[model samples]
Target chain A: MFITSAYAAADTAAKLGEEAVKKKNVFPPFDPSTFTSQLLWLAITFGIFYFLMARVVLPRIGNILEVRRDRISQDLEEAQRLKEETDASIAAYEQELAEARKNAHTIAREASETAKLAADKERQKTEAKLANTLAQAEQTVRKVKDAALAQIDTIASDTTQAIISRLIGTKVTKAELAKAISKIAK
Target chain B: MATHPDPIKQFAINKLLPLDINGVDLSFTNSSLFMVATVVLTSAYFLWSTGGRGMVPTRSQSVSEIVYEFVAGMLRDSAGSSGMKFFPFVFSLFMFILIINMFGMFPYFLTVTAHIIITIALAMAVFLTVLVVGFGRHGVGFLKLFVPSGVPMLIMPLVIAIEIISFIARPISHSVRLFANMLAGHITLKVFAGFIVSLSAMGTVGIVGSILPFAMTVGMTALEFLVAFLQAYVFTMLTCMYINDALHPGGH
Candidate 1:
């Protein structure tokens, strides 16, 4: 009964001071009787709290923070490595492209040079053959003319003999006729 | 007519479980219940918030994280990173006091910090830690904190005496500052509320008059909410400063 009805005694004990120390009030906070329990619970609660903070909760938070930081750094490093690789590959590709273009240009030039040289050689060969064939034809024409001239001389000598015989009833010399025809033909 | 309400009545403690051992009043008081409740609630919040323990934090997790960082930053700024060893003590103190202060604001709930015994116990803990760490780390050189570097030899004794007094008074002031603030703030709020009740009982004009006190009471309650956080912060900050002094004696 005395234990359950403690607050009933609190007010009077608070106002009266030391006279009511035996029937102490808890409101004053300095109540020596209640100090024991308050201090006891405070110690217990704070002890558990300290343990939780020092061991469990704080370390968890720290771990989360540290993990996040490490993950972010790793991501950044991966990104950097990827970027560098991309840049290097691009450079290599560009170099290869330039080399390929150069190679193509040189091949085209060599092909064109070869084609021009071949064309010039073919034209020269054809020109030389045509000149040789034209010279041979000219020589044949000259030979034929000479033979025709000789024949003309012979014909003249015979005509001369016949005319002479018909007009004057006298024949000319064959040698003299032949000589005149040859001079005329020349 | 009902007599004037005792503002102090709200602070009264009752024996919930009558326990005594070796003449000690170990009965479970209301104060013990709230203190236990504070512990339970704080622990539950942390455990529940971080239960998922996901990389991306939830709301309560964020809150807990922010509180941790906030205390860490305070300790780092005031006491340097070396002072981080005391992080648990300061953080627990801050959270315990903060929860108790917030709980006290609830209707019909008692503010535990309003008690000198509790505040003094906390202050003494800080004070004792400072002494132990200071002497342990700095040895006899720790006493140099009481004697400033630049003081003339003539006024050195005076200054030392004053420093010693202040040093001794650290726990007293620290404890009293919080206790008095909560005690007075709550008392003033009760007094204003009392005015409103008494005024409203006197009919129309009195009821109209009662509105002023009613409004003031609302405003004061809001202020008390702010004070609750502010006092907790101040206490934690002071603890950091004291710890800092221990770590670097005579540096200040």
Candidate 2:
């Protein structure tokens, strides 16, 4: 308003008022009359714009981006948790397998030791039975040999008596034959 | 039709609905219409894009998101994360300017940015915010901004005076740059187009001769499109830098 009044006064005094006002630069931007309205509208427009941006639009966009980031990070954490679980299961399986192998080894060693002890017991029992049989066989052989020697003595005595009787033509006495056989046996 | 189409006439403000209260004219204008249109268009675009609220953005959502990130990144680069508090302000300014600038390139649309008053209004807002924030946070210490470190004390007064003058001139330069560029580009386009119109009004020779100006107009239109985007970018970038200065007055 100040600028416009000053310019208007200057224009009239310069004597080029009519022509200057007609042209007026046609640049309505400099027209002080519109400045207030333009300024008023600008304030209103910018105020509303700021409210929309700060309160609604920017916050919405920022939220969307933030949610996406959190989702990605959550997925990564889940993958890590699954990996740890799998590793634990694998470790447990390996531990079980080792335990099974060690059990089998101990069981095999005990079975082998029991079989050896049984075999040794069986062998000792068989050897004692054989020794008893061998002693009985030796005693029977000695009795048979004594019986044969006694029979041979009897035969010789009988043959001697018969030969004496034929050569001398006399009957041999029983008591005499007995005494002679006795002397010869002695 | 008049013999000459006044290029300046295109910039003329007309009262669509006139209202005066207390000796002040408060009227709806063509400028006001376009500005309101820009606001509606921008608001609708953002709301529509975000309405779906998809995790993976749709086309419009992606576009809106890109614009958001672009301004966000600019703020981050200039003022760090602390300066993101002003994101809404800067973004609104950029979108408002960009849409209006592009609209002006169309056949019948008015460029709001072509006016010095509009730009000055916007620039003044940024300048005032910088001052308020700078002083509010730093107290009297904010004056350190005008006085650079390592300056010799003897010439300090002169340097300080110059710095203060430049600081005051920032909003003027900032606003004028955009206003002048838009105003100049549109004026040039209109002038060249006027040449074609006047030339064609003549005989076959005039029609053939209008080819040069026609080609120039086409080339200038293309250049103006680049300038439209460039001026908006420059304004937003400068605003961010100023905000950064306010937030960190120590020049760090």
Candidate 3:
């Protein structure tokens, strides 16, 4: 605003003076040097930031990072150790399990074998007992059948002799009647 | 030459807002939009990818699986088997940033990870997590992280102090590295674009500005694409490393 007003006043003054007046620009406007300033600031900013990071911050982070790395590896080693211990216990338990399984199989086999042997022995004993009872019953039935057959024969002979005596109305020889009866019966 | 007067100008989407507060004008910049885009796109992609998964992987499913396995492999490399615990966080960070950069190739969607504040915040989160987890696991022994084993008495104090400062500055450098690269690239692109306009306005004689920025733009774009990927990986990789610190304080 001041420059414009001064220039207007100068124009008026120039007409008054009638002599020519020089016009000068006290300040130059554009500076290409600002690019250089910009480059300078960029470099400085980068340098300062880099120093703070590489020299100061990065190392601290590196420390924590290193710690983190170290911690992980150590934990892994510890885990491996625990894992080994667990594996050892598992191996021992598995071995015991195997042994127990073997024992169980053996016991089961023996029990089954014993049971079969007992069954076989019982079957043989039963078979022998049945055979003995069959023999005893057969002997008793044969003796009773023989006694009844003798009684039946004796009764038939007496009836025949009595009937023959009634028909003739007289007594006959016992020996002769016996002889005749034997021949007829045959 | 056949394209617009300035392609780099196209890189920045100007959505002027009417809000101002504390003389600190806050507007939804392309960067902010891209950040939101990155998040939304990531969620959408994952959701869509795994939406219809069966025993066999479809194409999207395969892509999702590949990403999962890739991040898983990185976690295992940096954090060991137990590092599986941090799979979700590391994977999310990688995918989120990756998507942001990739999507930024579109006319819209700013590369949010390109911003210093965002990157710094991410790095700071990792730094804080490492600190908390380290101390929480090992307690005072964590301080010994700075004091190395078998250090001589004379320089121990100085070494410890330096170590502390360096530790504190990790997040700043990590974040700035990503932030500065993105910002510098964008700014340079913008400036070169200004040249293209001026040279063209100078009639047929001024067409020379086209050749240089064009070459630079292609080269920078290629480099930026790579940077986008590298930064995300770097961030996630660093995060995995930090989580590893938590898992194994002494590398057991």
Candidate 4:
């Protein structure tokens, strides 16, 4: 049964081959009859494809790419500008800080110098007042000493007169006693 | 009786809509259907992927963009920035061929590129575009492409003749390369598959032996997929180089 089926298949294959040969002696590709149809369809389809590509599709894709590139570059430029602005502000802040510190240093020095001058003037005034008080005290001491010396002279004269009278039981004359006292004092 | 599996039967064209213009048999065959499908699929993918036009591409959008950039970069490298004017044309050819070739990779799909007429038509389009652009840009000076600079005066004529012949033969080679690759790859795959079928019909031992051809068929299918992509790349790359030649006929 298998052999018979195989033989029948071979016979049918041969018949198909004969039929193909009868229809066209040439190979299907080499057959000139079908060229026109193939060419016609290729031209039509390729023409449509070219039209769609050129008119609609490619340009849109290209535009998308272009826009994306432009956006990226613009973003980069904006970032760069912001960075520069930040740097400038920081520099200005630092400079102001430095200037403020210098001003504070100058003001402190001026205040110390004024305080020192005031202190020196105050000390000199006190020293002059003290000297005046010391001179007056010395003059008063001298006057007191002179008054006591005068009193001492008077007292001595009286005492010497009294002693003479008491001892000798005689009344001595002032001139005589003075003459003796003067000689003794001398 | 099991029907005989004809490998060549896969390549046969079938009329879907019988079209006639004048005396021409321009019927909408299976080939036409595939071509239309390729166009529609390619168009839909690009349109849908790029619909959002997002600054950051979505996954589908990224795929679309990658293909766009890949072809653009290839063209820019071979043809210089000035040749970017032909970007749409080159892009269409690349995408169309690529999608159609991929379509052909299915089990029972018609390979539009497998047809000689289709490939020749594409190559001829490129050829004619080169002629037009070369002449339009350079005028008579385009003939200088045939004459190399610094050739010895004794051998100058011979060189120009050879250059002209090669130039004339460009379309033939370009078209045949794609057609033959698709045709041969598909045929090889079908033949191996046929072996498996016939072997399995034999019996228990035949089924075991069929494993070898089955593995081979799998391998061939994988290779065919690669060829589909590679041939598309090669075809477009050559297109770029040719356009470059036209744009700069001096070959500098």
If scored against the real structure, what TM-score would every candidate get? 0.77, 0.72, 0.51, 0.78
- Please compute the TM-score of chain B alone for each predicted structure, in the order given: 0.97, 0.97, 0.81, 0.98
| Pairs with backbone N, CA or C atoms under 3 Å apart (clashes), candidate 2 | none
Q: Which candidate is the best by lDDT?
A: 4
Judge the docking of candidate 2 as incorrect, acceptable, medium or high: acceptable
Error of 3 at A115 (Å): 53
What is candidate 2's lDDT per residue for A1-186, written digit by digit as tens?
999999988977776666457546646667777766666666677677767877888888777767767888998999999999999999999999999999999999999999999988998888888887887887788788788876776677677778888999777776787788889779
Cα lDDT tens digits, model 4, B1-252, are 345577777788888999888979999999999999999999999999999999999999889888889999999999999999999999999999999999999999988898899999999999999999999999999999998999899999999999999999999999999999999999899989999999999999999999999999999999999999999999999999999999999985
| DockQ, every prediction | 0.46, 0.37, 0.01, 0.56
Q: What Cα-based lDDT does every candidate model obtain?
A: 0.90, 0.86, 0.64, 0.92
Ranking by lDDT: 4, 1, 2, 3
Point out where model 3 deviates above 4 Å. Answer: A1-186, B1-32, B107-109
Residue B247 lDDT, candidate 2, scale 0-100: 96
Cα lDDT of candidate 3 equals 0.64
Q: Write the per-residue lDDT of candidate 3 for residues A20-86, one digit (tens) a residue.
A: 2211111111112122322332234333433433343334333444565687899999999999999
- The share of true interface contacts that also appear in candidate 2 amounts to 0.51
